[model samples]
Target chain A: MATTTMAAALGSGLRRAMEDDPRVVLLGEDIGRLGGVFRVTDGLQRDFGADRVMDTPLAEAGIMGVAVGLAYRGFRPVVEIQFDGFVYPALDQMVTQVGRLHYRTGGTVRMPVTIRIPYGGGIGAVEHHSESPEAYFAHTPGLRVVSCATPQDAHTMIRQAIACDDPVVFFEPKRRYWVKGSVEDEVLDDALPLDRARVVVEGTDVTLVAYGPLVVTARDAALAAADDGLSIEVIDLRSLSPLDLDTVETSVRKTGRLVVTHEAQRSGGLGAEIAASITERCFSLLHAAPVRVTGFDVPYPPAKLEEHFLPDLDRLLDAVDQVMGRQHSLTGWSA
Target chain B: MLRSDVSDGRALPTTEEPPDPELVQLLAPDGTRRADPVYDAWVEDVDAERLLSLYEDMVVARRFDVEAVALQRQGQLGLWPPLLGQEAAQIGSARALRPDDFVFTSYRENGVAYCRGAAPVDLVRVWRGNALAGWDPWAIGMATPQVMIGAQTLHATGYALGCAKDGVDSVAVAYFGDGATSKGDVHEAMVFASSFAAPVVFFCQNNQWAISEPVGLQSRHPLADRALGYGIPSVRVDGNDVLAVMAATRVALDRARRGEGPSFIEAVTYRMGPHTTSDDPTRYADPEVREQWAAQDPIVRVEQHLHTRGALSEDRAQEVKEHAEAFAMELRDATYGMTAPEPLTVFDHVLVQPSAELERQRSQYAAYLAMFEGTSGGDE
Candidate 1:
């Protein structure tokens, strides 16, 4: 095992995939010579030839549309949308073509394409850099959506995503890219399933569910809650689309309280779906209403307000308190 | 913009040929044949057997089109897009393709699908609402029928680019209606194809009507002339004449295979039926206009020419009828027997590895269905 950042793990994973499959290609703007802005594709073009690591035009739609055609011709394309807001231009192709190609062809064609977008806020970046748009793709039927929180997950999940036969939207939390963790060099003997959730920290008072960058914050909240004598269980929902509701329902049933958190907008976000599903599945076991701590239902705020807008440990702990029927006043509470 | 420059040049031909520049009609309405020596080299290798096959294709395609319309009227299909008068254009261009060539098409080209080896029953799935798509596109070297106008053009161009990168001689074809010319993707496709010198052919079946909009609204100049701006050669052929369309497509496909870059062909035809079964053309079209195109029916012209040459007998015509009826009955039976897909099947192919959220949704949906089954006497 070796300690590495999430970005390094992703770069290493892409290199491994290229080494494994000659047909695997990486296409995005400013990915080749400059490494990506986030450096997720650093040293990829140098390790592999230029043909396999293409520096495409600035057009996202063209990148996605051409990738579809390339996939049709038996090429496994891993495309990178530089930021969350930049992915909107490619939405039409993603929804209408990439998502529907297999069903529309009656299972004749398989689009083994992965669209990687660095999503969510907390980096104090400019506008359009941080937004949680996972709900849009999760709502789409034909596509699969997933995100990674740790370095190990970023490495393993990306390879698994690239190996998937269907089109997958792989969202990477930009803020978590620099976090360091030990990565196993050998193949995992029993790796986590691609579409399941994992319980990171076990507790009984309340189940705190989150994913991607917010997962770290949720873990921090769980640690702080433990100090307060409240055992807050933490569940990392790795796959957003085919949610691992069995794990969620099981956790909610045991805890009798739940708090769903994310960096995406509060209204119609993925957390809303999780809350509703848990409520429906474990309605009788609920001790209090499910509470959600998410980014406000507004545009990603300016750099100064990003921390306030993003769900931090305090905000998540407050959500836990609310769900656990605690009466303590929380930090950063607005008048 | 119309300028008369006759003073500085020689007199042009004043014969009774098409006044529209770039329009080439080799076969007259009266079944008389005319030839331009420049185009003779393209058709020199085509023999009588091939010509007879082309005619047979037109006849068979028309029969199937009629059957589809009848099926729609009888409520077997939700809707049908009839290619009644455009049989020559579809069959001619489709038959011209070699086994290795790839074809991308918009919906309404059932004749082309037939030419690509898809069974008639396979084509009924989309209309019956049993499947989102009809046939296996990879099995027939064709892409799924694109319903959105002109979107397949970009896909075809990109595929051709892939072929060029691999140095393959296989050519790709994009078939669309006249209205597709107005879409941004079509123009983008042309630009990309020309820049890359991709081996592709843009085959447009200008069947006069785009739903309610006429061809005149789609283009000011002939559709073929639009290719000149992109530095590609274009040809306009009489879509009603199967022989002419076949010859034109053959030359274009050959040029593409020889790495000569993309070519555009505008097959001028007319939609002899409504846009779809749901459309009522009686509200928009004039009776006299319909009569004018009916007189130039593609199938009748070939039938009459073959009969006069003593190549088609009454017995042979009867055999065609029997074959069409048999195919139609086979399709009806297959469609009637198609069952709704299982509920869990929805989660089967979403991804190679099902996601946690999808797994949860699938189980929840299954439980919902189970609850209903337990509460009710029947599973609906």
Candidate 2:
């Protein structure tokens, strides 16, 4: 075992995937000579050659359409959009072609295309670079959407997503890419399936559901709540589309209080679906209605305002406090 | 008018860029065979028997189009995009391809699909709303026809790129129309194909119209000229002349197979019928102009050429027509007999392994369906 960042873990996973399957290929802009803007695919081109690690033209639709075609011809393509905001150009190809081909062809054509997007705000980048666009992909029916919180999950899930026969939209939390953690070289066979949710920090008073960049914040919030004699459970939802509602329901059944959180706009976001679904499933067992701590229903704010916009530990604890019927942390940027 | 050249009865409009005088023409509209030093050698092996077979292919394709349109009109099909007057362009180029060469085409390439060995019933499976997929693409080496305009061009480029990486010599061919050249996907496809030197053939049958829009709106010059901007060689062929189309396709296929990168072909043709069964060509196309194009019919020119050469007898042509009629009748029967698929089958192919959410929904749907089963029948 060696300590590594989420980015390095992803690189190792990609290397392992390519080493195991000759049919696995990578396509993205600047991925060949530049590794990647975030360096998640660093040194891959030097080892795998330019043909396997392709530096595609600066066209997202072209990259996506080409990836779908590669999948059509029995190649598993792992494509990278430079950032989450730029994925819009390829959304049509993903939703219309990549997602539908398998369904359209009645299971004969499998779209084993893994699209990686460095998403969520953390780096002090410009407007388009740090946006969270998971809701768009999660709403798309044919795609399997996922997000990795820790380096270990990132390492394991990246390979699993590449090997999956269906198209997967993988969201990498940009904020956590460089956060270092210990990782094992060999993945255990008993590792959780790519779509299951895991409880990162367990407690009893309330269950706090989070994913991607906000999982760490939820964990921190749970730790903080423990100091005050309040127990909070933090659940890291790995898959966003086929939500592991059974695990969540079990946690909610124990806690009887729920809080859902994300960095996207609260309106029509994954939080709304989680809150409504949890309410419907565990209504009789609940003590209070599920509270959603999410970003505002507006465009992702500028860099200076992002810290306030993003769900921090204090803000998440506020939602947990509200569900626990305790004195809450004030809910605003000033707090 | 489908094109600005409707009044002149020519395929290209009189723009700042005129039609290339070097347009490959082995057979003119008047049934005169012209010998070209460059392309004539490509078609030398097209003997009288092969020519007759090519003519029969076009004849049968035209029959299929006529029958599909009739089926749509009779409500047996949801919609049909008629490939009228472009039979030679589709069949001629498709016949030039080896079975291993994959084809990515727009929804209008039923003729190419047929040549790729798609069954007649499979062609209408999607149109009849019976199934999401009509046939297995792997079995035919052709993808399910793409409906998003010009998108398949990118797929062709991508597939060829993969083939190059795998060291496969087989080429990927993209079939689209004049208006599709205006799409960003086509431009991106050419750029990628050229930049990577991927073995791709962009076979564009410029049918002079995109629904109601004229080709002039899509291009100021001949569509073939646009290929030069991307560092790819191009050819403009008489789409009505089956031999000319075959020669052009052979040249492109040869270039692609030789690892010389991509090539483009603009098969200039006209749409003699409505864009689909729902369209009314009379709304925009003038009768006199349509008559002028009718004189240059792709199948008619082949028939005239065969008659002038005495290569095929009238009895032989009649037999082929009878054969096509019998196939059309079979198509009608197959279409009428197609049963509606099970309602629950919609959830079958969404994923290789159904997710937990999908599984719950499928079971709930099954239970809901089960609710109606025993309550309805006296036999129960």
Candidate 3:
């Protein structure tokens, strides 16, 4: 077992996929010599040479559209969108072409293009850098969307996502790049399926669900709640699109309460869909409606006021308290 | 000042643009043959039989277009983009490509599809609402007809990049109209193609009108000049001349296959029909300009050239007419006889392996369908 940061794990994951298949080509801006803005692809260009690892012109649409073409020519293209907020320029290609190719072609042409984006804000960056835009792609029909919170999950999930025979939108938590964990070298845990939720901590009172950066926060919230005699179950939802709702439904069935949290805005967020689906699935079993701990429905605030904007242990704890029918915050106070 | 900038309105492209001296032409409009110094050797292999075959291609493709428009008008198909006047632009360039070369095309270019061996059924599959894909990409080396303007240029560039990496000499071609040149995707495609020196042929058929808007509204300079700014070798050809178009495309294809990087060709043609079955061209099209272009039709020029070469016997002309009639009949029959697809198939092929969530939804939908099956009355 080797201890690695999320960034290093991602680098190794890319390296492994390239080593396994010659068809895998990496394309992005500043990725060749600079190793990308976050260094997730550090030393790849040196090892793989310029053909497999390409420094593309700085155009998100061109990068994505080129990736689609590469896939058509039987090359497994791995594209880096650079950042989450900058992906809007490539949305038309993603939705109309990448997402529609397989269905439109009646399964003859498999996309197999892995698009990586360093998403979410907690590093106190400026506008467009700190936004959570997973919902836009998750809501799209043709994409498989996932996020990795830990180094181990980051390594295995990125590898599996690349190996999959469909287009995958792989989200990496930009703030959690330095987070470290022991990665079993080149080993993928068979028990932890790609489309299933992982139980980070098992408890009974309320289920606290989160993914990406918030998984670590929710785990801390559960530990803190444990000290207060509140048995909170923390589930790290790895896949966002075909959400491992079976795992969430099972947890909700057992705990009888739930809380969902994310950095993205509340309206039309992944949390809203989770809450609604659980309400329908475990309606009789639910003791209280699933509570949401999320950012307000506004643009990601300026860097200075981000702490107030982003959800942390305190907010998640409050959501747990609300779902558990306990008095914590926002309880029966008339303003 | 803004009012004075426009005398009548947006600059309507005049038919009398002082006959372009730079335009490459092997066959002139009046049955006259011009010998181009550089391109004459390119088409030295085109004998009497080869020239007649090109004439036949133009004839058959025009018949297919007429049939498709009639199908759309009769409510048998969803919509059809007619390529009435640009037959040479499509057939000439497409015939120059090898079978291994891939093509990414716009919604029109039924002639190109014809050259690529697309059956009448395959060509009209999407328009008849029978299927999303017109034909398999692997089989024909061409992608599904793209409706999004200028999007496929990037695909062609990227495909060329892949071909270069795979150590193959097959060229990747992109076919679009003049209006598509103004799109951001097209601009980005050029930047990427130029930066990587990808072997892509950007074939833009300057088919004067984009719906009701004229090409003058999109670009002031020649479309080929726009490509020249990107450092890609550019050429302007007389689109109505089959031999000229064939020569230009062969030059571009040869350059790309020789690993000399991308080339751009602007075939200046004219759109003779509405943009689609739904558009009304009479609103904006100039009758006088249309009449002037009528004398320069793509098929007429090819027929004139074929007659000069002693290739137009009465029996052969009758055979070509019969072939075109048969082509139109096949499309009409196949379109009318298309089988309806199953409703449950909508949930299929979204993923290589359907997720458990998709399976659940499919089952739920199946149960809903079961309810109607069990009842006496059903909603169709």
Candidate 4:
């Protein structure tokens, strides 16, 4: 076992994939010699040569479009989008081509491609750098969307994503890149299922569902709630698409209350979907309306205000308090 | 007018004898008999059975195209991009491809789609709003018909690049219109194709107009000549001449399979119909221009030449017409009988795994749908 940050885990995972499969290639801006701006791909080009670790032109659409072709040739391309907002230029290719290629081709072609984007706010980043756009990909069919919170998940999930026959959007929480954890060096023959949620903590008061950067916040909130004599169950949704709703349903059924959280805007966000699904499947079991503790319904604000804009431990606990019919005001509380 | 600089310096070498320079005429206008020795060798490979099959394919595709336009007129389809005059260009090039070759096409190549084995009924789903795409492109080794201008060119180039890496003998052919040459992706595709020496054939159907924009606006030189700038050889043929288009495509495909790299062919044709069912060409084009192109109709030339050669008898011609009509009727029945996709289908394929967000949206949408259903007594 080795202790590593999320970014380092990603680099190790990418290196393993490249070593395991000759067809596996890396393509994106600043992903080659520079090892990407975040250094998630550091040392990859030096180890694998330039052909395998390609630094593509500053065209997102071109990168995706070219990757589609590369996949057709039996190459597994892992593309890195510089930022969340910058991925829009490649949206057409992602939606129209990558997401639909398999079904459109009657399952004859497999787009074994992975798109990696560091998303969500916190750490005072500028516009376009910190934004949660997983919902957009999760909304597209024929694509798998996943996010990693822990370093272990980041390493294992990246490998799982590269091995997937379908295209996958791997959203990495930018703020969690520095967070460290123990990573298993030897490849596990059986890793966690790529599409299921993990119950990080067990509780019966309220089901706290979160992913990516929000998972850390949710776990912290749940710990704080524990001191307040509230057992807040925390679920880390590793996969955004093919949502492990069974896990959510089970947790929601037991707790009879659900509070979903993410760093994206509230309106029509991933939380909205989670709330609706839980209400439909676990309707009679719900103690109160499923609430969402998410980013405000506005563009990602400036660095200084981002902390307030993003869902925090207090906000998550407040949401829990509201759902459980407790005093909502945190005015006099000190953690 | 055809530009001189585009034509003057870029003519095919004269010494080896160009492939039937007489427009590669298999059938001539005015019902006359004519034969060129250059293409005679290739024509021998096209036996009586193959010739009849080619004719049948063209007829069926043309009928399908015509019926689609009618369907659009009757509001059965939202719109139809008619490939009326350009049937021969598509049919001829499509026939040149083997089953192993892959094709990436622009949205207008309905004829090529038919030849590639997509059912006529499948085409209706796209225009009828029942599906995002008509059929599975991979099943037929054809990518989905790309709607965005010139985007497929880059895809085709990438496919070709992959083919090179795999050392596969298969070549990828990209079908686009004259208008697509103006797109940055197309230019970039050309650059990539040339730089990598990717095995590809860029088949550009120069149909003279891009919606309201004339081909002249898209290029100052011939569309084929634009390829020469990238160190790729290019050919321009009378797109109305099916034989010429077929011959040119065959050569390009063969060269690509042999690892000779990419080639571009500009099939100079005319779009005798509107840009789409919703468009009105009368607003932008001259009546005289249409009249002139109509006189040079692709099918008419073929029929005239076949009749002169005694290869097409009056009875055989009648049989072809009857078959075409029967095919059209069968397609109409199949297309209209297709069921509109279920509303829930919208939520089904969005992702391989349902996300918390998607589940939420799906449930909310279902609730909204239920409210309407309840109010309308399940009508929705």
lDDT of 2 by residue, B69-175 (tens): 99998999999999998998999999999988999999899889989998888988999988867789999999989999999999999999888877878999999
Question: Which regions of candidate 2 are displaced past 4 Å?
Answer: A327-335, B1-22, B374-380
Best by DockQ: 2
CAPRI tier of model 1: acceptable
C-alpha lDDT score of every prediction, in listed order: 0.82, 0.88, 0.89, 0.83
Q: What is the TM-score of each candidate against the true structure?
A: 0.88, 0.96, 0.97, 0.81
DockQ of model 1, rounded to 2 decimals = 0.37
Per-candidate interface DockQ score? 0.37, 0.84, 0.84, 0.29
Ranking by DockQ: 2, 3, 1, 4
Interface RMSD of each: 2.2, 0.8, 0.8, 3.1
lDDT of model 2 at residue A257? 96
Q: Of the pair 1 and 3, which is ahead by DockQ? A: 3
In terms of TM-score, how similar is model 2 to the real structure?
0.96
Instruction: Rank candidates by lDDT, best first.
Output: 3, 2, 4, 1
Fnat: each model in turn: 0.40, 0.80, 0.76, 0.38
Query: How do the residues A37-117 of candidate 2 rate in per-residue lDDT, one tens digit apiece?
Result: 989889999999998999998999999999988998899999999999999989889989998998999899999999999
When summed lDDT is taken over every stretch of 10 residues in candidate 3 chain B, the lowest stretch is B1-10
Candidate 3: list runs displaced more than 4 Å. A186-191, A328-335, B1-19, B374-380
* Per-residue error (Å), model 2, residue A147: 0.7
